[model samples]
Target: MGYALTFEGLRDLAEGAAVLGTGGGGDPYIGRLLVEQQLKAGRTVTIIDAAELPDDALVIPSAMMGAPTVFIEKLPSGAGNIAALRALEAHLGRTAAATMPIECGGLNSMMPLLLGAQLGLPVVDADGMGRAFPELQMETFAVYGVSGSPMAIASDHGDTGIINATDNRRMEWLARAMTIQMGGASYISDYPMDAATVRRTAVPGTLTLARRLGAALRQARAEHADPFQALAAALSGTLYTHGLVLFRGKVTDVDRKTVDGFARGHVTLADLADPRDQLEITFQNEHLVARRNGRVVAIVPDLICTLNSETGTPVTTEALSYGQRLTVFAISTPDLMRTPDALDCFGPTAFGLADPYTPVEHLTAVP
Candidate 1:
């Protein structure tokens, strides 16, 4: 079934997408405002399940490519997304039946909605990554043999370029360089696929999941209940079924830098009760690995999220600072994302970590 996103629902979607983003996707607040502006103008953003898409329909995944830290300061011009999509459509010689998110995290999650509202096209409720990742090549679409090019990119100023790379990895490298030249960030439309391919490769129902996650957190807070508990219950019904609160503490140190078109660094947090008990999280645009007291509690391909300890609001990597109370939560990703082929693309070693990939459930079960 298909439905229109009311203004109220957009808020919850952004909130939930941020949590799933694991502190890497661009600011959801900014993305929310963009979508809200369109909705206020009486435009409707219709969301259809991937299964509802016609087999031959064209779907273009849209997103912002750049460091989330840079995106905070250099706001998009709003025209860039449309420009990219249009350029891609021109190159492909076919109109997009719909636009969809490349990742269901932070700002990227909202980019397709914004585009769909502006273009009056439906937005598919599926995405390449169930969560956000730093690099462009790290997507389920690419993992399942979708080429990243015939891709298009556009800057806030409407500067546009098309990439026709030999491989997805090369496509990312080229796009990253172009993003830097386009002033640290740009809008992109890529991995143009038929609906049948989307059904097979994309993570389905993430948009709905994000909305549900957001509603759960909001409802839990309204009832003065444990938001984490509510979050777990919400996950219990979704494809991402495992959720755990790994640590509760205060930020003690942050070593983040914007380099190579990424927010690369790590954060350290001390147990709220014991200064000696600490958790360290490393990231390259997203939380990739987490260690507590010298033990690996979580690693990539799984979700490592940071949230406000009390309010349960998600905190992005760029927002992490000293002395803020926080909770680090881990959730298991879907089985499709853990296969040997998928691991080859986004495993712990993919991020330069020495540890082997371990399921969050198994890692958390450690005494």
Candidate 2:
């Protein structure tokens, strides 16, 4: 089924996307504001299930590529993504039938929505990554053999470039360099594919899922219920079934820096009661690994999300600071993302961790 996104729905979607962001994917608040600008201008965004897209329809994924830390300080001009989309369309010599998110996390999740509203194109209810990943080549679209180039990138100043790389990895390398040159952030349109390809490779219903998750959190707060428990119950009916609180504490230390066009760093949290009990999360733009007192509690390919302890609002990696009370939540990734090929792209080892890939369910099991 297809539906039109309302202002209220966008709020829920952004909130949910932040949770799914796993502490990366730029900032959802910024993304939401971008979309809100379009809506306020009388533009509307229509979301349709991937199944509703004709097999021949061309789908382009839109996103911002760069260090989230820099993105916050250097806001987008809002013209970059549209310019990138236009440049890509010119390169392909065909208008896109629809636009979708390369990843369903944080700011990227709303990129397609903004594009769709601005261009009056339907937004697909799917995305390449169910959650956020650091690098462009880490998407399922690439994992399942979709080429990321010929892709187009645009800067806030209207500067644009196109890359036709030999492979997705090379595409990512090239784009990363260009993004850094664009002042640490650039808008991009990549992995232009037909609807059938998107349907087969992309994670389905993620936009809907995000909206549901946000609604669940909002409703839980309204009812004076535990938001985490509400979130878990919400996940029970979705493809991502297991949601658990891995740790609850206050951020004690943060060692983050932007390098190679990524926010690469780690944050340490101390238990509210036992200061000796600690949790450390390492990241490259997104939360990749969570360690509790020197032991691995949750790892990549799984969703490790940091949220406000009382409000259940997601806190991005760039926003993590000392003395903030936070809850580290972990959710299982879909089986598609757990496949060997998927792991090869975003596994713990892929992030240079010695810990082997283990399902969150198994890692947090009670003995």
Candidate 3:
């Protein structure tokens, strides 16, 4: 069946989405706040389990593209996001029966939730990538053979356009330029497909997982418990099963910049107990790779996330800074993302990392 997200339940959902966002996906604070406001005004957001989607139902997977840094400065013009989906519907010659998050990390997760509420549509209870990835082509939708063409890109200024390309990568390239022109951030709805395809492409239960993760954190806080332990336990059996504390330290250095409309940077963490044993985390919006004392401990396709050691709050790439205390956690990528085909598309080589791809399950020995 389906369920509605209540205002009271938002804390768990937001915190969980941040953990799943893997240190990217932009912060979920704005998204959560927006949803809370809507619910406070008596609006309802319904989420249907992926399996509940009818075989022929139309589902549009979407995301907000551009630097997370820019999104903060440029709040979306609500109509522009809905207009993009409407534009996609126009191109497809049909109305969408539902919407799905392209990736369930940070603000992007909130876009679909908020949009669904605005459009009075039910959101599928799953997402393309269980966690967030940096690019549009990094989704299970593409890996499972769905084309993201005949897409729609819209800006907050009532400007919308349809893009029909031969592949997903080209669409991203075209849409990216448009986002830059639209003032560095825009809403994009692509990979529109049917429920059958959605069941195959979507990472099941992620929305619910995000909620539970958030709830656990909230409970931990109430009891003055270790939120990190709560988070690890929450992720133990999902597709993101292999998760463990990789390092606990104080941030001593940060190098960041906006490159090609993406926030790219690395942070250095010095162990609180043994200052000389440092951990280096490199990221392109999302945390992508990590090394501990010169040994590669984690890499792309696996999550490398940092939480405030004291409060269990997530600290994304754009927010990393010096003297901040942190606990770094590594969570395995979904099984759908670990295959040979999926790996070639988003693995180390694809990200320009010199080392060959190695599983975090193997690298850090989470088992």
Task: Provide the lowest-lDDT 10-residue window in model 3.
Answer: 72-81
In the range 1-367, model 3's lDDT, one tens digit per residue, is: 8989887666677878888888889888877877776677788899898678779899997678888888778776566768889999998999999998999888888888888878788889898888888888888888889999888998878889999987888887888888889999888899999999999877888888899888878889999999878888888777778777889999999999998889998899998888999999988889888999989999988888899998888888878889999999888877888889888877887789997778887987646
Candidate 2 runs further than 4 Å off: none
Number of backbone collisions per candidate, in order?
0, 0, 2
Tens-digit lDDT string for candidate 1 (119-208):
999999989889999888889998999998989999998799999999999999999999999999999999999999999999999999
For residues 296-338, what per-residue lDDT tens digits would candidate 2 score against the true structure?
Answer: 9999999999999998989999999999999999999999999
TM-score of 3: 0.97
The per-model lDDT (C-alpha) reads 0.93, 0.93, 0.86
Better of 1 and 2 by lDDT: 2
Runs of candidate 3 with Cα error greater than 4 angstroms are none
TM-score of each: 0.99, 0.99, 0.97
Write the number of the candidate with greater TM-score, choosing between 2 and 3.
Answer: 2
